[model samples]
Target: MARCEFCGVEADFPFICSYCRRPYCVGHRLPEAHECPNIIFARPPDHVRKIFEGRLEEPARHVRPVLTSELKQLLLAWLVLGFCFSVNSLTAPQLFITTLLISLGTLGLGFIGHELAHRYVAR
Candidate 1:
């Protein structure tokens, strides 16, 4: 089990950066405003600029600079698309099997993409 670096808590499901290989707990994870991989991949483009601007406007806390630009854009794009599909499914015609497949596929893709993102990003 990996212990959280910031909180010193034991974690079986530690969220680690695939690029940097740094382990962190959910609590210790980067804020949505920072430019971490989670921010780059998980955040919508609309919010990233606001995050960037906030950091500049506030001098109370230090913000880490983006260290690397290497990323799996395709995987991130696919995962984002899957999320959209799941959301849009609310209005989709209720085809039982189709809905089930879409839901399952979305979950599977999300899990796989998360791991792959870590693998590609972590050194």
Candidate 2:
């Protein structure tokens, strides 16, 4: 059986501290409780910490547009059209030359419509 590194109590299932590489009981499992030596090295550098703290102090600036109901419908239409085009093309190859041409045309139109919808929604 393994033992807790801090309190020396027998532990059936000890939690391991990642930094110090020591097994500890639930009560002293955290790095701070055990006073882990590697805690100093584990911290981010001063500059990186300052940048993160600065961002937290600032309010959100940008208001990005989310996907509305119309955008969702347009995206769904593109997905369904693309699926149909794929199925038609695969089946059309075994059918006839005219069928193949028609499938190709449908696929092209679907691709163009999908691109146009994407551009419209983005703007």
Candidate 3:
């Protein structure tokens, strides 16, 4: 049988404080009731806490899109193309403007092909 950490009572169905991971009886189940130490550390510093203390509560929102979002994936695709082009140009400096254009076109097509493959696999 588990015992409550605060009142030392035998608990049949103890509630655990998530932060400190301690068991408590129904009466002391809440963090406040057990005077949980985590509550103090979880709070922001006094100076920063005061600034937003009176702000109106707003519904939670996503701050930013995921790194793998479409926009980021597209940007990464272009970046890889540019890097490959730069490395090829440096290695073979004799390539003419026509060759550069062909390389760019090929990379663009390759990027499109990759996207199509990804979509096909997803379906």
Candidate topping lDDT: 3
Instruction: Please identify which of the two predictions, 1 or 2, would achieve the higher TM-score against the true structure.
Output: 2
Q: Which tens-of-lDDT digit does each residue in 29-118 have in candidate 1?
A: 663422355445654556333357456543356755555343355456665665555665566656544764675587757767786788
> lDDT of each prediction vs. the true structure?
0.61, 0.73, 0.75
Model 2, 2-119: lDDT tens digits are 8999999998999999998999999889888888898887677664323474565444478656877766776666556555655645655555455544654677567667777888
User: For every model shown, what is its TM-score relative to the native structure?
Assistant: 0.25, 0.41, 0.35
Best-performing candidate as measured by TM-score: 2
Model 2 ranges with Cα > 4 A deviation: 46-81, 85-123
Ranking by TM-score: 2, 3, 1
In candidate 3, what are the lDDT values of residues 1-123, reduced to their tens digit? 789999999999999987789999999888888999897765576643333577755556767656657757776776667566756566576664445556657786788778869878998
Candidate 3 colliding pairs: none
How many clashes in each structure? 5, 0, 0
lDDT against true structure, model 3: 0.75
Q: For model 3, how many clashes? A: 0
